[model samples]
Target: MDITIEHLARARLITTEDREIPVSATLRYTTCDPLAVYVDFPAEAALDGEEVTWTFARSLLDQGLRAPAGHGDVQIWPCGRTRTVVEFHSPYGLALLQFQASALRRFLVCTYGVVGSGQEDMAAVVERGLSALFGGV
Candidate 1:
């Protein structure tokens, strides 16, 4: 299934620690052979408005979500069915992002070919390889 993001009603970034930072942000998913994910921040006195774009890759989706063990600048993990946990270590904070998992899966499939049933057994090997490449999970 080719999942395309039409529009996001609303999205917010929450902090796990004490911080007075604004968490309002907009998300837009563009349709393409390889989907493009964009997160835009409105202009504010603190920030002059910024937009970040992440290009999906086949290998990334196969690896799934991950977080740096011990301490790290950023952490990412899957939460529940439709939520994702993103933690930023800068100034110590975290954000709970709510998105459609179906859309995510579609984006993954579009970016990277579907994972075959035969590849299921290699999940552990892939994880171990990624962990080693990433300096341990």
Candidate 2:
């Protein structure tokens, strides 16, 4: 239920007029090693439907393995990584957990590729992941 992080990562975010539109991105971070990053599409809107919620979670875990880093605003070779789950109560508005290719595959196989939760938990996951990946102020 509680996730704490104390590492500095490279990241940037921007909001557009479209609320429902999913934000695509590629991110990389160092966790013990130069961890390759992958994530699902951005999970926008409050997750109310079970199917939709799971969809976003699965996407994130699924893509965690592959490296999706880039040098521009838009991804060059876009890959569906992981959807961000936000935890406002903790700190950051949301957290985007980047799954490495091996980690993604391993998690999917080990966990049966299930991701997501109610808005509250989703937010918690997001916040925790963000804090871990990026430095929290």
Candidate 3:
């Protein structure tokens, strides 16, 4: 599996101390290690003058992304009808991220390819990913 970019969006990183920074970024993952995902933002996107990459362990992210409805330090779930929300909590601060459904669908297709149940439509792939993350919502 190759390192694939699944989605890119205009995002805002919100810190626990109430600091928010705008960014253009993408999410990437590989089949060789589906448990890990990478969030990559360019050097210019960094406020501290360094390129930033965050590797999310499957266990931690799975816990955060599937945090039992309304519980946990990190929470990820659908928002409205066409968006997903990801919130991270830490002793130092919090980070909130959101992405569009259409973009996510494209990312899934690009990363996983249009096959299996998703061959019919790219949205199906996104739906599958969301289901896995939210436990069928």
Order the numbered candidates by lDDT, best leading: 3, 1, 2
Q: How close is candidate 3 to the true structure, as a TM-score?
A: 0.53
lDDT of 3 at 73: 59
Which stretches in model 1 have alpha-carbon errors above 4 Å? 1-10, 15-48, 53-62, 65-71, 89-96, 113-137
Write down the TM-score for model 1: 0.39
Candidate 2 lDDT tens digits, 60-127: 43342343333222222223553322211113233233222333344344333122222234455467
Cα lDDT of model 3 by residue, 46-65, tens digit: 65667666666434443333
lDDT against true structure, model 1: 0.42
Write one digit per residue (lDDT tens) for candidate 1, span 1-137. 44344333343345345433434444444323232344444554122344433333233333444322223543445567665444434342333444444544554454334333233335555676688899996
**Sliding window of 10 residues with minimal summed lDDT for model 1:** 62-71
lDDT, candidates in the order shown: 0.42, 0.31, 0.58
List per-candidate RMSD values in Å. Answer: 9.5, 15.3, 10.1
lDDT for position 20 in model 2? 37
Query: Candidate 1, clashing residue pairs?
Result: none
